[model samples]
Structures are given as structure tokens and as C-alpha cells.
Target: MKVLLIGPAGSGKSLLTRSLGEWLRRGGYSVALVNLDPACGYLPYKPDFDIRSFYDIRKIMRKEKLGPNAAVIRVHELLSNNLEKILPELKIERDFILIDTSGQMELFVFRETGPKIVEALKDAVGIFLVDATLMNPIDLVTLKLMAQVVRLRLNVPVVPVITKVDLVPEINFANSAQLTREIRKQKGSVVDLALALNKSLDGFDIPVRVIKISSKTCEGFGELLSTLYETYCECGDLT
Candidate 1:
């Protein structure tokens, strides 16, 4: 199974990718962690497979007189051409593959370069992580837009995840009234965003599930794991 991790910068996409890969491996699934962020200089742990072997953003920026965003776009252009070489070189023997993409969420989700990557990896599961801090209605509206972009342009099944929930324990999914009230206080109108998202996803069976996870504390990690296993794995195949 191919999984594409997409999220805004500093939204815990890389951390989740690392934690998920290690957990999957511990569960006896041979997994390959592909680092697709060429501009990313540091990783907490080494990735099993990385694209930095093909292109380095520092070099691209210096050679092309581009800013960070432009450098990322350049990396995308380079990777699109060289993906065949890159993926094969990964030598992924696992049943599942995890792609840790750039934190520039819009760079990928809203651009042709991003759609091309998803199209190239059509077999992959597309996961979009929204910061738990953005669980408010207004931010959810923005996330809904991001989700729509992923669904409409990428042609991949999208999963919405809320990260950093450990930071806020009072807002529990089990308490709908409290959650709704908190959401209203945080954002003006929860119903408005929900209605907007519902209209945008007309006829499209988008699997929208909000998962809470903290890579630091491992809070809600088990639920996240169970969700992925149930959603993506075969009958006891990758369990």
C-alpha cells in the first residue's frame, strides 16, 4: 500500500510518518519510509528511502536564484522527472510504503506538480493532516478547501487527521455538545463550515475521519494505528 502524507508546515506530518513507519515495522510489516522533502535538512531518524539523493534544495536555490518556495517547486519539477529512478532505487520490499512529503501543504495540494505526484502514485492512499489547533470552525473551513483540492485534483482517497490533540484534552469527541460549544467559541459558526464542506463534496464519498495524535506523548496513537489498519490493511494481512 502506498500512503501519501500531506499537511501544512509544522503540522506534524513528518513526525507522524516516522512514528507510523516504526510502529508498522514493529507490527511485522516491511515498510519503506520515503522522504520526499528535498528542502528538509533534518530528520529525527533516518528514512529508509530518501529523495535527497537526487536533488538538494540548497543547490537548486543557489543555482537558480530562487527563494524557499521556488526551490521547493524546483525540487518537485526535478522529482517528477526522476521519480521512476527514485522509487526503484528505494527497493521497497514492504507491503506498505510511507511518503513523508514537504510541509508546504499548498505547494503540493493546490498545484499541478502535486497532482502529478499523486497521479503517478495512483495506488497510494492520500492522507491530509490538519493541526488539532485548527479544529475550530473557521480553520476547518480552510481544511475543507484543502481536502476538496486533494479530492478533486489528485483523484486519490483522502483522509483528514487532526494532530496535536494532546495539547487540548478538554475537547473530547465523546462530548458533542461541549465540542460544538467550544468550536463555536473558537470559531463563529460550526454549522456553516460543515454545510460548506457538505456542499463541496456533493456525491463524492470522501472518507472524512478526524483522528487525534501526539507523536511526542503517543496519546491517541493506538486509535490512529487501528484506524489505519482497518482502513488500509487487508484482513489480518498487515496487522
Candidate 2:
């Protein structure tokens, strides 16, 4: 299955891609790592297919005389235009293909490139990573909303993953009811807004199975793998 690792900058997408790919390989699964981030300077694992070889962001910045942000935008434009070039590389047989996306989440998901790329793959599942340290009830609601938006934009199945679990204490919110109660304890109009949004999201019947993992320690890898299988198969059975 093709799994796209997507999240905001510093949310551990690349690290998770590296660690997860390594774990899968060690388990005797054939995994291909694809780096789609042109602005990323260093990656923990070498991608079998790297976009920089096609469109270098630094070269775009130099040639177009654009700033860092503008150059990134230009890179996405190039990616959208030249997507056909990368599709063949992704067609090879593999048990899993883990794609690391751009660090700036908006540059990828909000742009035309993200959906186009996913449509090309046709069988891709998105793993939307949320930083565990940012998991206050209000922030969690906000992230869930963002994940929903990403799913809507891409029109694909996206699993919300909590990354950096080692940095935070155990998260024990059993359901949206627990989350709503926690939000009510906070004192702010923002908290009220979050409550309303959370309720609306619950009405949609989105099953958010929280899979927390620590890339540094490889904790929760098994649960993550099972969730991926379950998501891809659309069945409860992991086998």
C-alpha cells in the first residue's frame, strides 16, 4: 500500500517515515521511501525517489529570484506540472511505499498538487501526524478539524496519528464526551468554540482512532502498522 506521511512542520513526518520504513523492512516487508519535500535539507533515510533531483528548490530560488516561501510555492507549481514524470517511479511493486511530503503542510494539501498527486496514485492512504505535545483539548479539536479538511481536499482516507508520544504524558480521553468535558473545564470563548466544533465533528461520525507513536523509541509501531492494514482493508481484521 502507498502511505503518505503528512503533517505540519516539525510534527515528525520525516522521522516517522524513516522509522516506520525501517521497521517495515526489518519485518521482511518491501518498503519504498519517497521524499517529496524540496525544501527539506536533510532526511533521516535516503529516498528511493527524491523530487530534488527533478526540481531543486534552491535552484528555483536562484533562477526565479524568489524568497524561501515564494520558492516553495514555485516548487509546488513545478510538481503539479511535472507530476507525470514521478508517477512511473512510484509504480514499482512493493509491500509499502512511504511518501514524505513538504514540511509546510499548506503548501502541499491546500495547493492543487496534493490532490493531483494522490489521484495519480489511486490507492494511497494519508497518515496525518499530530504533535503529541500540542494535545490540549482545544488544540486537539483544531488539529482534528485540519485533518478533516485534508481528507476533504484530497478526497482520500486519512488516519490521524499522534507523534512524539514520548514528549507528552499518556492521553486518556476515551471519547468526544471526555474531550468535551475537558474543553468545558477551560475558561475562554475559544474553548466554547472548540466545544461547538467538536460536537459538529462528532455528528459526522468520523471514527478517530488515536495511534500514538514515538519515532525516537519506536514505540507503538505495531499498533500503527495494524491501523494501516485495517484502514487499507476497510475491515477490523489485521491479518
Candidate 3:
């Protein structure tokens, strides 16, 4: 099973990738971890295949007389063309493969190169995460909007996850509880928004799972693993 972990910057995608890798291994599965960040300075776990081998945005921009933004665009193009070349080098014997993608959400998810990479892998799963701290009405609405974009472009199963639940408890307990109470009070507003978002999706029945994982306490790790296993099995990626 190949899974892609995607989220905005500072959304804990890398840490989740590492934790998931360990979890899969403990379940008797060999896993390969790949870092797709071309400009990443350091990674907590070594990647089997890194995009830096093909293109480094900063270095390429300097050599080609391009600005930083242009450099990143060029890097994307290079990866698109060279994706096949790198795939052969990957040993896919592992039962699970976790890909750590760039924090540049739009660059990868909506762009041509991003879609091509997903096509190169068989039975790929897309795990899109939203920071729990960003769980406000307006932001949740925007997230659903982006989910539509991803669904339209990618042909893989998209799993939406709420991350950084550690911050949930830290959120003003009074304010958080009050919001929940308000949600209960104003079910018309809150529940209506959720229902509308679900109606907008193709598979409205696939409920969004909330995972409050802490690399610190390993909280919610079990739930996350169970969800991932069931998801993969249901998608026929796991036997």
C-alpha cells in the first residue's frame, strides 16, 4: 500500500509520516519512507528516494538565472519528466510506502506534476490533513472547497484528517466547550454546514475521521492506525 501524507506547512505531515511508518512496521509490514521535498534541509528519518536527487529548487534557480518561485516551478517540471526514472529505483517489496510531500499544498495537489506522481504509483491513498487549530467555520468551509479541487484532479481515495489534536485541549477549554455547546445549540448552522459539505462530495458516506495524535504522548495513535488499516483494506490495497 502506498500512502501520501499531505498538509499545509507546520501541519505535522512529516512527523505523522514517521509515526505511521513505525506503526506499519510493528504490524509486520515492511515500509519504505520517501521524502518528496526537493529543498528540505533535514529530515527526521532517511528517505529511500528523495526528490533532491533530481532537482533542488534553490540550486537550480541560481544556476538558471531564475528567481526562487520560478525555481520551484522548474523543479516541479523536472520531477514530472523524471518521475518514471526514479520509480524503477524504488524497491516496492514493502507492504506500505509512505510519501512525505511538500508543504506547498497547491503546488503538488493541483499542479500537473503532482497528479502525474500519483498516477505512477498503483493503489495510492491520499491522506489530506487540516490543522485542528484551524477548525473554525470559515476555515472548514475553505477546506471543503480545496477538497473539491483535489477530488476533481486526483483519482485516489482522499482521506481528510484533523491533526494537532494536542492543541485542542490547549484551546481555551471554556471557549472550546462553549463552541461545542454552541454547536449543539445552533445545530442549524454548524450541522447544516457539515451536511452541505458532505452533500457536495461524491462519497458523502465516507465520514471524515478526526485523529488527535501527539508525537509527544502517542495519543490517538491506535485509532489512526486502525483507521488506516481499515481504509486500505476497504480500498483493496491491503489483504
Tens-digit lDDT track of model 2 for 161-195: 88898988577562678888989898877987898
Clashes of each: 0, 0, 0
Residue lDDT tens for model 1, 128-174: 78877666644554565675577677776666677777876654642
Q: Local distance difference test, per candidate?
A: 0.70, 0.83, 0.68
Winner on TM-score between 1 and 3 is 1
Would you list the rank order by lDDT, best first?
Answer: 2, 1, 3
Cα deviation at 97, candidate 3, in Å, is 0.8
What is candidate 3's lDDT per residue for 1-239, written digit by digit as tens? 78888778777778888777787678788889998877667787878877777777777977999876566667877877876777787656788788988867777786788888778776677777777787764355445555545645766666666677677755331122333343344435556675455345424544444445665456667776676666666656322
lDDT, residue 196, candidate 1:
51
Q: Please give the lDDT score at residue 197 for candidate 1.
A: 58
For TM-score, candidate 2 versus 3, the one ahead is: 2
Q: Rank the candidates by TM-score, best first.
A: 2, 1, 3
TM-scores, one per candidate: 0.82, 0.91, 0.80
